[model samples]
Target: MIVSEQYGELRGRAFAIAYRMLGSVGEAEDVVQEAFLRMHQTLRGGEPIASPRAYVATLVTRLAIDQLRSARARRERYVGEWLPEPLVTGPTPAERAELADSLSLAFLVLLESLSPRQRAAFLLREVFDYPYREVAEFVGTDVDSARHLVARARTRLRDRRPRYHASREHREELARSFFAAAGQGDLRTLEALLAQDVALHADGGGKVPALGRPVTGRERVARTIAAGMTAMARFGVRLEPAEVNGEPGAMAYDARDRLVGVLGLGLADGRIRTIHSIANPDKLRHLGEVSDLGLRARAGERPGRET
Candidate 1:
C-alpha cells in the first residue's frame, strides 16, 4: 500500500520530531503510530491528502504539543531534578558530533522551559528548518506571530544554549579523559576537565537516590563525581563508554552487569559544561535491564561518601 511505503519513509523523521518535542521515547513512538493510523484512515476514507509527509508531520506536532502540555504538570511534581530519558545513540563519534547541537540532553532540557506552542514554533523553525509561514500553520498562528514566538524562544534560551567548540576527535578525547578520571576517583583530573561553572544534574524520579538539585561549580561537581564513582566502584559498577542523547556519555552496569544508569555530558568551550545522569529505573528500562538502585540504596549501597 502507498500508505505503508510512506510510513516506512516518514516514520523515522516523524519519530524524531515527536521525540524532540515530547522528550520521551515511548510517548514519541506512540505519537508517530497514532499519526500514521490517522493518515491511513483518512486515505482509506477517500479524503484527498496532498502530501502524506506533511500531513503526518502536522499530526505528530499537534499530538506532541498536547502530550507535552499534559506532561508538564507531572514533571513539575516529579521527584528530584527531571531530565529527559536517555536516547542511546551508540558509540559513534561522527554521528554524535553531528547531532549534539539539536539532539543533546541539554538542548532538550532547555526546550522544556518553553511553553508548548512556543516550543512547537521554535522547533519547527529553528531545529527543523521550516519556513516562518509553515511554522505558523503548524502552531496555529500567523507568520508574524510565529516569528515572534521563535524570537522569544531564542531569547529565553540564548544564555544556556549548547555550543560545541571542539572537533569530533576532541570530544571523544575529552569524554575518555573525563570518564576515566571519574571512574578512578581522580579529583584533580576531573576538576581540570570541568568548566568553572559546570553543573551536574541527576534524575531518580524518587525511585532511586539522586541529587535533588544540580551540583554547580567545578570543585563541587568534580568532588561529587569522585566520591560517587568511588562508592559505585566498590559495588563492582563499571562505566561503559556510550553515546547518549547524541552526546558523549557512558552506561553504568552493576556487579551482575545490569544497567544502573546513563550519563550524558554537554561540552562548551572545549570543557565539560553539563553532566546529565539518569538513574531512574523507569527511564532506563528502554535501554536495558535496569538495576534496582532504589533497593540497593535501601540496602545500604548508596552513592557518595564524605571526602
Candidate 2:
C-alpha cells in the first residue's frame, strides 16, 4: 500500500503521542513529520512494515524522546518561564474531555520531573497502555529497566493531585472565571478562588527575568501575579485565552502582537491550584499569532465550547 493511504489514519495517533511526550505542539509536529519521512524512505526502499500504525508510533516516540533530550538543555537556558505549546484541535466533546487531564499544564509540568528515558517509559506504559516489553523496545532498554523507570516516574508524579475531573464545560467555566478576575485585577476574588496552597511556576528558559523559584501560597502567588500583570498592562502586554494541553489557558502578546508568553492553569475541585507561565521567546515560536481575547470570548459563547 502507498504511504498516502496510511498517513491519515496514523497522523492523529502519532501527533497525540508526540504531543504528550514533548508537550509542545510544534515539537510534536516536527517529530511526526520526521517519522513520516523515515517511513516513506523505508517504503520507497521496498521495506515492508509489519504494522504500519505501530511502526509510525514507535518512530514518533523515538524522535520525540531524542528531541526531549536536547530540549532539556534549551529549557535550562530559557528566558523567564517555559510552557508547553497549546493544542487547539477540533475534536468531539467526549474526546476532548477524555484527553483534558492527561494534556493539562500540571500534568505536563509533572512530566518534567522525569528524565527523558523515564518520561518515555511512563508515557508509553501509562498513557498509551503499552505493555512493559513494548515500552522497553521503544526506548531501547530491558523490560525490567523500563518497568523500574515507569515506577519511579509514577511515584514522583503521584504527589501532584489530579486536577479537574468534572465535565469539560464546568472546567472551562472555572477557567473563564479565573481569567476574568485576573484581567479585572480583582485581587479579593482571585484569592478566594485560588486554593490556599496554590503554586506558580515560570519557565523563562533562563533568558528572561522570571521567578527563579516556584512561588507558593495563595497570598504570595496572587500578589506576585497581580503585580506582574499591573506592570504588563503599563507596557501594553495583553492576555488572551488559548488552549494549552487540551484545557483552557491564555497567551500573552505585546503591543506588536508578537507572542510574548503562554499560561497554563491547574484546577482542583473547581479552584485554581497551580499556574504555569512560559515566557521564553524560543518556546513561543509555535504560537504564531497573539490570540485575541475577544475572539476567544466569542468562541466560548457558543454552546458546548470544548477546548
Candidate 3:
C-alpha cells in the first residue's frame, strides 16, 4: 500500500551502493530491504523526509559500513583466495558493461584492503559522485576527514585496480577465446591470447580446491588453467558463457547441474590480462539454477579438443 515512484527510482541505486560496498549480493539486498523498511516505517508515521534520496543513501551507507566491519573478520578466516561473488548479468550485455564492471571482482578485492570508513567514503565520493560535504555527513565525519578517507582508499587501490580496456567487443572476443582455449587445453592458443604477465586468481574460499596464491606469468597461468580444465572434465563439469559483471564470462556447472564456478576476465590490448575465477560454492549460490546445454552443443563447432 506504501508503494511510490520515488522508492522505485531509489531501489536500484540503493542496491548498487550496497553491492559495491559489500561485494556480496545477498548482504546488499538485505541492507537495502532493511533500509527501505526503516524509511517506509518513518514515512507511514507522517515524518517528512525533505530529501528522500540523500536520507535513504545515508542510511544505506552507514549500514553497509557496519556490515563491512563485521564481514571483514569472516573474510580473514576464509580459505584460499577469497574472490568477490561474481555478478552474472542479464540479457543486455552491452548495456550492463559500465555499471556491471564497476562491481568487477578486481575492484571489489581492492576495496577489501580499505578500512570500513575509507571504503564507504571512496564509494560515496568516487563511485556515487557524492560531494565531500555530504559524504562527510554520511560517514559521520567532517568534510576534511571525508576527503582524507577517499584519498587513502585511492592510494591503496592505485596500483591494484585493473586497467579496464575500452573496447568491449575486443574484450569479449578475447574472453571467449581464452575460455575456449583453456577448456580444450589448447596451451598454444591460450598462450597467444594471454599476456606474458597474465595473472590467474581463483577464490575457492577453502570450501573447494583452488590456488592459495595468484598464478602469475603467462606460462604458469596457462598450465594452471589447463590443469583446471582437466579437473573439470574429469568431474564432468560443463561451462556456459554469459555476461559476467558486465563483461564476457563462463559459468561451470557440475554433473548434477549445480553451479560450481564462475570465471570473469580482465582484458587489455586484445589479450587476456587477468582471470578471476570464483569456485567457492557459497559465492556461486547467488547464481541460482543455470543450464547451458545450448552453449555446450555449440562448442562442437569450435576447432578444439574436448576438455
Candidate 4:
C-alpha cells in the first residue's frame, strides 16, 4: 500500500548501507526489506517523518550493526578464512576510485578487524560521507563519541587500508592479462604483474577445497594461482571477466554454465596486490545458479577440460 516515487532510490541506498555494514548480500537484502516494512508501518500510523532518507538510513545501519554483532561468533568459528560475499558488478562506469576501493574485498576484510560500532561509524563517516552528528544518531552515540569511533577505526585500518592510483582502463586491462595468464598457468607472466608482497585469499567455507591460509609473496601466490587454474581446467571450469565490487575481476563457471566462484583483485602501485577467490556456494547463490561444488568434491569428479 505504501508507494512513492523516491522508493526505488531509497531502497538502493538502504541496500548499499546494509551491504557495506554487514558484507553479506542476503542479510543486507533482508535488512532493507525489514527497514522499508517498518517505514510503511510508521507512515500508515500517521507518524510524520521529517526526512525519510535519514530515517531509513538510521534503521538500516543500526539493524546491520546488530546483525554484525551476532555474526561475529559465527565468523570466528567459520572454516578457513571468511571473505565478504562478492558483489559482481559487471562493467559499470568507473566511479571515484576512493569509493570503489571501499567496496573491495580487501577493504571489507580489514573492516572485520574493527568492532561493530567502530565499523559502523567508520563506514558512515568515511565511505557514505555522513556527518558526525548523523552518524552518532544512527549508531546511538554522541557526536564526540562518533568522531572518536571513526578516528579509532582509521587508526586500526591505517596500515591495512587499500589504496588505488591506477586509471580505470589500466586496471581493467591489467586484470584481463592477469586472469588470462593465470588461466594458461603462465607463472612468469603472473609474477610480472603481481606486487612482491601480493597475497592470494581463497574462501571455500568448508564446502569445497581451498587454501586454509593466505598465500603470500609474489612467487608463492603466483604458483598457487597457477596450480589452482590448472585444477580448474581439469574440472571444466572457465573464467569470465567481470567487475567485482567495482574493481576488475572474473567469475568462474562450470561447463554447464553454473557460477562456481568469483575472483576480485586489489591493485596498488600499478600492480595487483591482492587476489580474492570466493568459491563458497552459499555466497555465489545470489549471482545466479550456483554449481554444487561440494557434490563434485565428494564424488571426486574430474570431467574433461573445456575451452
TM-score of each: 0.93, 0.83, 0.88, 0.95
Model 1 lDDT per residue over 1-307, tens place: 4656766778978988999998999899899999989988998899988877778888998999999999999998998899988898863555554478889999999999899988999888888888997888777779999999999999999878887868777888999999889888889999999999999999988888889899999999999999889877776678998878877899998876789999999998889999999998888888878877556785676454222
Candidate lDDT scores, in order, read 0.87, 0.77, 0.80, 0.89
Candidate 1 structure, TM-score to reference: 0.93
lDDT of candidate 2 over 1-307, digit per residue (tens) = 6456567879988987898888887888899999989988998899998888778878987898899999999878765556676654446677775566677777877788889888888888987888998888888889999999999988888857365676767767888888777778888988988899899998765555567888999888888888777756765677887777677788787666767677878778778888887765556666576433323322443222223
Candidate 4 lDDT at 66 equals 92
Candidate 4, superposed: residue stretches over 4 Å from native: 1-3, 90-98, 304-307
Pairs with steric clashes in candidate 4: none
Off by over 4 Å in 3: 1-3, 91-97, 290-307
How far is each candidate from the true structure, as Cα RMSD in Å?
Answer: 3.2, 7.2, 5.6, 1.9
Lowest summed lDDT window (length 10), candidate 3: 294-303
Residues 158-205 of candidate 3 have per-residue lDDT tens digits of 877766656667777787788888888999998999888998998866
In the predicted model 3, the residue pairs found to clash are none
Residue 305, candidate 2: alpha-carbon lDDT: 22
Model 3, residue 2: distance off in Å is 6.7
Best by TM-score: 4
- Following a full C-alpha superposition, what root-mean-square deviation does model 4 have from the true structure? 1.9
* Residue-level error in angstroms, candidate 2, position 153: 2.4
